[model samples]
Target: MVGSIKSGKSTLTNALFGGDYLKRGAGVVTSIITRIQPGHGLRARLEFKTWDEINADINQALILFSSTPPEDGGGDFDINDEKDRLRLQHDLSRLNTDQLVSDDTLDPNCVLLTEYLSGYDRVKGLVSSEPVTHMFESDDFHKQKDFVGDESLAVYLRDVCLTLEAPRGFGENLEVADCQGSDSTNPLHLVTIQDYLIQTHLIIYVVSSRTGVRRADIRFLNLIKKMGLTKNILFVINCDFSEHETLADLKGLVGRVEKEVGMIFPAPCVFTFSALYNLFKSIDYKGGVEQAIARKDRRRLEQWREENDMVAFSDQQTEKFLKAVIQKVSMDRFALLLVSNLERISSISSGLRDWIRINQDLLKKDAGEVQEAFSKMGKRQEASDQITMVIKDTLDGTTLKLRRNLGNDVERFFDSKSGEIVQDLTRFIRSYNLSIKDYEKDLDASGFLPTLYRIFQTMQQTANLFIAESINPKLVNFVRQEEKKAGDVFEQVAGPYSLMIKDAVKQYQRTMKKLGIKIQDRPFKAVRSPDVDSVKSDARLNIPRLAGTIQYSTRIKTEAILRLSIYKTVKTVKKLLKKPVKEGPDSAMRSLEASVRGIKKQMQESIKDHFLDYKESLKYQYVFKLVDAMSIELYEALTDRMRAFTGNLSDMKGRIENEGLAKDRLAEELASMQTSLNVALKETRALEKLVMIDE
Candidate 1:
């Protein structure tokens, strides 16, 4: 499930699962993506961030600490130093209230800084080489809220894998994931959601009725479109029962949301319901502390039902939504998996029938005829080996070209200065205005030093957000394009080989027919193209994180700042910061430009490294691996067709030598095999018809 913060995603997740499996309205920013799958009982496997990842996060947060002085008077803040840690907190306190915290919302960067300072010790022991597992069955399930709902603890988690007893009507293979809000203040939350979307088969985008189609919703929907995932998305306008008085009011709001969303995704499948009401209805509140909360919620539910009378309408929409989900998931599995298996069964049965017929024919023949047939079979084996060599040579040549093309494509897309993604970021950075004049009052109340620090911190956040919102989506799209290209290449190479193998089998059958061994004249089925998902690279595209790369001395002389008039000082600062000069005093503009350039350079290197690893994976792990597997599959298929004709000739001759006991035995064996084969074939045909009808 994906949506903006507090759009009833967690509530919807609970409602869909038939219980409150997740903490609803978690006020803190959620960094971890919770993936739940059908299982026998309640359990969770929490993967904590590695030590290196933790240190990196701390360092990034330190960069965001506006007043953090450079260690030893020149270097960045040392997270491990007690003195620095103390100073870090002191510096945090000095930050302008607007930059530090505004109302309930904290600056994303500061949140990271504070979370590390607060929770590092608490979660350190849990970060080992392997993930920690928890049994959430019986009374232990409530304990999950302690980790998931708490920001400090949740920030330490990399991802969550939760397993609950399969919810009613939930497909056994369906895995649902609850992603962080799309508009989360933390830019990394957006990046994390993109990664999940790439792997998701379907996206249930929840939009709260309280806040109809938001700008964040549109931005996220566009990103989904850019990633080529518009078709599989289902939108839900989660109603706030308190906000809307009547059923008509809710319906009108749903229509507005659908129209707005339809502008992005045509004919969007939209459902309207009160996620909270659904949750309240479904939840089995165990007594004790839960009883009071349940009683309050039940009262609210009663009032809403009595006033609005929209329960039946909501239930109808929800049922339709559930049915749509089941159909999509089931159809995908049936078309991609079941049909392929059925085809294999059909091929195997056809081959088996041919083999039996050949053996039965050989059984009627004398030893002399069988000897002649064996000689012809030896020649066919040599021919099969020749076909194998051709397949190997073709794969080797095509795979090398495919690897080179993929490597070059990755390099071009991530080039340091001129690359598409880097350029887009660079343009945004250069055009971004800090409006130093607006902070003049801040400069007067807070010294130039503190205000200067705030400006730099804002730049860091702005640049980070740009990369997350703009650059990350392009990177995902690039990888998807590359995957398709590689798949197409593999399919092209496999086509000829599939045909060649089939032709070879046909020739062998014709040769056997000349030897008076009757063989079936059925044509070979074309091999199915290698599935891209089957060979998908395990490497996830991790957009390099934004950190405090821009460093400058904040220790200006206090007397010097007080000496300058406010108007003159503000003018000087703006010119110093915003001027496009290649050389200048440590102006905020120059610092920001330098920082952005450095970030772009770092991003380029990071992307290059990622693609280098990804290229190798595509070659060995995906492309070449697919080629090898398909070659083996085609070879085995060819051999299966001809093996019984050749390999069984010796057995037929040996049985003939044993005093003519072959005919009766061969007849009985053939009859039993044909009966079983016929039954299987009949069932396969029936399944094929059902699959066709379903499609």
Candidate 2:
């Protein structure tokens, strides 16, 4: 699905799959396109990008993160902000910039892989909010430090391929791919998105209701249209990160998106569902917790939710979200659309099968005429030409008819669905809610201050929001979810075609027995689901440190202030003890309390800057790794049946032309198979008509 950062693509993937398998955070999580299909058992086949690809992504990420250009909201950031310079220095250090400046080659062994599972385990064991590093051997191609899953897999996870099965409704042909933000700072990742779009049959384009459609969203969406994914792109307005929106609020949001995307594709209304709210109402929240518990991956999700107040927040959203999703952008409607797509494919296939059978039957009936004409040497060529002409004309007509039917059916589906949403858009984004005025009275609440030193120490306590919090749970859950989805997609697509075609063929052969010889049954080979296994790269990069590195940049200055304030407090208290002053003890204590309060904002800002520095890298890293990898996988899975059926058509046509048959010509009662209203043909046409009629 296409979406901007934090627009809920990862969450939606989890929601649709009925689990929170993909990681969600304040930063980017889908640096990789995660292709979820059904698998035989729980497994993941993660493929690391070649060193060059990795370098390219890293270079792009580094550039985007390095410069504080105007678009990055450039400003005179607080003096406490050393992250820009620190990050710059770190990049330069790793790149061996000094050697580059000296025109000397950097070490070729620089690309060596290093084990990170142990390091991650150590960090995990520490269980502090502090940030730690798990190094990546990203600079060189020749280096190798083998790190396999020994005890933990958190550090090893970046771009990954996972296969697991736990969701109750997993299907073999159903594949869900989670993509990174369209406005991703990484341009290379954008290019990767273009490559993936060519094969995408379904896309959940997520947009924030609050942000609406910006220029980047327009640009990215247009690219998708240019790549011929117009029909597959499903726009969903995620209000998960914002305040609770009423149906009317959603309707207005949809109107904005429609106007933006309408230039290319007039999406009357987009799906507006809350991934965060879904956590409370859907299995994505409940089922995933259960699965995680079973998998022993529960601690992180449980801890993070409680820490983030996700439970309280979710409960609040649940009250209003039920009404919003049900009345406005219902997931149920989206589910129907998916089912409709499947039926459309099945119906089209049925039509093609009917056309093929009709041609072969006609060819069979004309065999006698050809034989008779062959007795005369001069008439043989003319007779064969006549028979070929009849077959060719029939073939052309069949193609045209089926093509016309498909075009009409698909267009009508879009039109009706579009119209329905257009009518509902206003109602969907309705105008309803309560308004409140500010409190009329202000109460002065006072607290006890033990001492100037104690107050400063209390304000200086760390923010404790971990740089790694919620990240690992998202990684672990998403990986296992993909493994599960792979199995669902594989089995659903693989099982149906053979069953449907075999039933049709059996029906046809049974009826054709009147020709005096029975039609033999043919075995149809089913496409096997691709086998997946764990693939560990010999390269690793040390994860960066964010939280652990956090400390007041003005530590010395702040400490000095605290010491002076203490001295003044001590002196003031002594004066009060020795001789009564004009000011009482209360007045002296108030001055000390005020000084401590003045430092609170400064200290908090310092803490904010420290966390924002390194954690900012996560806004785009490891996100597209799965996105790029899985798009290719899903593309293959999606096209498999189409490819297999094309082959089947070729083989069937060849068999009919080559085989000599002896069947009692059932009366013209079979009515030219081309024009025959056989049970299967009637049924297929009937279903097609129903879809068209619904429109």
Best by lDDT: 1
Q: Model 2, residue 316: what's the lDDT?
A: 56
For model 2, the local distance difference test gives 0.41
How do the predictions measure up, each by TM-score? 0.82, 0.37
Candidate number achieving the greatest TM-score relative to the actual structure: 1
Candidate 1 — which residues are off by over 4 angstroms? 64-84, 101-105, 128-137, 284-293, 304-309, 431-440, 537-683, 693-695
Q: Over the stretch 1-695, how does candidate 1's per-residue lDDT look in tens digits?
A: 99998999988987777677787777556567788888876777676776666666666555424454333344545555677667767777667676676335677767777776777677767776455544466557667777788888888777777787675666677788988889887666777777678777789999999999999999889888877787688999898878987889888988899889989899999998888887777663433444234667778977867754688888888889888877777766556556655666677777777777877776677778877877786687688778767766766677667667776776677665667876676566656765655666765676555564455566655666776667666776776676677667766766777677777787787788789988767766666555555433223222233222332222222222333344346667777898543344234333333434444444444444544454455445544454445444444544443443333444554665676575787679788999998998888888878677221
- Could you tell me the lDDT of residue 655 within candidate 1? 62
How far out, in Å, is residue 452 in model 1?
4.1
- In model 2, where do residues sit more than 4 Å from their true spots? 26-30, 39-42, 50-159, 162-171, 225-229, 245-251, 284-289, 292-382, 385-695
lDDT of 2 by residue, 535-582 (tens): 101112122322232344333333434555675677788897896545
lDDT of the candidates, in the order given: 0.67, 0.41
